[model samples]
Target: MKINANEIKVGMLIEYKDDLWEILKTQHVKPGKGGAFCQVEMKSINKNTKLNERFRSNDSIEKASIENIEFNYLYDDEINYYFINQKNFEQVEVKKDIIGEKGKLLKENLNVDLIFHEDKAIGIELPNQVQFKIKSTDVALKGQTVSSSYKPAILENDIKIQVPPFIESGDEILVDTRTIEYIKKV
Candidate 1:
């Protein structure tokens, strides 16, 4: 389907120049002299390359039609991660590069949406919020205020995230998978 440039958002996949492009960043700017435009940074899903482009607010772009299938995480090997459909118990394998660092967030039986283009798995989307335990974090000093300070911490999955001053090792917290940021104590 076609969408106005102003409607573009980060993480949306759109077709342009014969390739599927994932929007990495988008900024709607209205300059003093010219009309408003959407500045977009895109990454090619197939070639793994990046591009920056601008679109007029009135312009329209073709949004890629993708298939989203619900799957439960099973396991992974050296190169691929495996998932199984809950309803049919069918299994599928997706490449490691497709998921990259996000693979660390995968745990047993976590339900995720697999994005397919032309019947090929291009990406996987994790749930918005997932629970994890803090593996380790620095001790907050006595004089430190709790209002705006955030401290670096590591999760049991070994992913680094920032947590509030009150958080400590072994604390369970909810994390936002999209931004990999701490949401709240569980």
Candidate 2:
């Protein structure tokens, strides 16, 4: 699909110069005394390097097509993580680098979004927020409000997250993975 530079977004994948790049940032600038233009920051999917370039207001770019499908998390070894296609139950393995820390949240049978370009798995997008129980943390001090101070706590999955001052061991909370921030008490 063809898209204008002005319409680029942070997470959109685009093809340029025979390579795939993910849009990291974009800005449409119209100088006070100059014509309008669009500036973009991109990260190369293959090389893992960032590139900054500018385009005219009307420049067109190729938008890479990706399909997001439901996949069930299976397991992970040292080098790769595995998922099963829910529709046909076909197994797929994606490199650890592609999934990064997101693999930490995967539990057996959990459904997740897998991004595919044609038949090749390119990325995995986990849910925005996941519910986890605090496994270990100091007891909440008396008279402390929720906003008083944050204490580090470990979730049931062994993921480290900061919780509100009033949160103690065994408390359930919602965690925002995209920003690695605490959302609310669960």
Candidate 3:
């Protein structure tokens, strides 16, 4: 679908210069002396290259028509992650690089939205929040009571994150998958 540059948003996929690109960031600028333009930084999904481009506000760009399919986490073999469609019992495998750090959060039976373009899996969208147990954390000192202070802690998956000073080891907490930060105690 063709969309005005003004409609572009971060995380959107678009086709430009014969390559699929993922929008990393966008900024709409209305300078005092010139017409408005949308500044965008996009990374090529096919070539893994990045480009910074600006478009006139009225310009149209081809937005990639993508599909999101729900799949349950099956397992990984260090190189790829496997998922299954519960309804059809169909299995699909996606490369580990495409998932990057988020691959560590996958758990058995966890549901995810797999992004596909041209019938090929391109990426995944994990739940915004997931439950994790704090594997370890530094003991909070009673005298150093800073309200905004956070302590570094490790989760059961071995990913480290900062949490409230009061959080302790073995406590279950909700974590934001997008930012990989602590949300609240569960």
Position 68, candidate 3: lDDT: 95
Candidate 1, residue 108: how far the Cα is off, in Å: 1.7
Q: Worst 10-residue stretch by lDDT in candidate 1?
A: 100-109
- Cα lDDT tens digits, model 3, 25-70, are 9999999999999999999997889999999999999999999999
Task: Work out the TM-score per prediction.
Answer: 0.79, 0.90, 0.90
**Which stretches in model 1 have alpha-carbon errors above 4 Å?**
1-10, 25-40, 53-62
lDDT (0 to 1) per candidate: 0.94, 0.86, 0.94
Sort by lDDT, best first. 1, 3, 2
> Candidate 2 overall Cα lDDT vs. reference?
0.86
If both were scored by lDDT, which would come out higher, candidate 1 or candidate 2? 1
What alpha-carbon RMSD in Å does predicted model 1 have with respect to the real structure?
A: 3.2
Model 2 quality (TM-score): 0.90
lDDT of 2 by residue, 2-56 (tens): 9887888899999998888999989999999877888999998867889999988
Task: Estimate, for each residue in 110-167, the C-alpha lDDT of model 1 and write its tens digit.
Answer: 9999999988999998999999999999999898988989999999989999999999
TM-score of candidate 3 relative to the true fold: 0.90
Higher-scoring candidate on TM-score, 1 or 2: 2
> Which number leads on lDDT?
1
